[model samples]
Target: MEQNDGLWQALDAMAGEATEYFQKARLLQERMAGITGTAVTDDGYIKVTWRDGGIDGLEINPRAMRMGSADLAETILRLSHEARADSRRQSDAVMSDLFGTQNPAGIVADKEGLQESIDMMRDVFTGAIGDSKDLIDRLQRRLRQD
Candidate 1:
């Protein structure tokens, strides 16, 4: 019989790499959860904190009430959007630093670009995992034969 071409070792290495990536992903998620995207008005009367996909805290100064209910509501809404955007930027920066990947919004030019990137990755990983499975099966068959 010929040599095995180190297939088993290669598989082991892939597994180790996958484990390391998952660990890093977990760490990133944990850090993201602790992040609070904050926004405040120019006068520092109104403040907003965004977390876990929504506004978590809002502070309105008594003086802000002088703007009337309508203006105050509009300011709050504006601050919420700003806070959310700030949160996304922070998360994207951290993810890019760790993974060498830009946030989809930053990298994509087309309207559907983010989804397209995701689809491409899904296809590539699916094909790779399928090919790896086939190789493993073939190796197992050869082992049984031997």
Candidate 2:
């Protein structure tokens, strides 16, 4: 029937949209995988690169040898933290570019929102099940009276 044909057409269009969205997501993921962030100490004695949530590369200038071991270690740690912050900023940019929002990662990271969603779903299911149970009990009582 014509109505059936229209329904099929609508379903096909929805499927095509879903496929396009998934393809874009895949491409964005690939691009994000290639992203890297780098930072260097103020004196340029230490450089660090962060990728995929970990340190990918580190370089120490020969001038760094003039410093004591403790100083050198402290500098390295500071540079590493800077590099990690840079990486997080870059990742946020990528997420914004792909999703047209800057808070997708924040939303995913938000335990409050996640917990609220879970609680809402649980409440809905519990209410539905309770209603079904009440209906079943009434049906059983009516059948017994019959």
What TM-scores do the predictions have? 0.69, 0.63
Residue-by-residue lDDT tens digits, candidate 1, 1-146: 11234545655786997897888888887888788899999999999999999999999889998998888999999999999999988988877776665443465755577788789878866766776777789889999999
Overall local distance difference test of candidate 1: 0.82
Best by TM-score: 1
Weakest 10 consecutive residues, lDDT, candidate 2? 1-10
Instruction: Please tell me which predicted candidate would have the highest lDDT against the true structure.
Output: 1
Candidate 1: where is the Cα deviation over 4 Å? Answer: 1-3, 102-146
Clash tally, candidates in order: 0, 0
lDDT of 2 by residue, 1-146 (tens): 45445555655785896787787688778988988888898888789998988889999989889999999888888888888898888877877777763245766788898788679768855665666666678789999999
Root mean square deviation (Cα) for candidate 2? 7.9
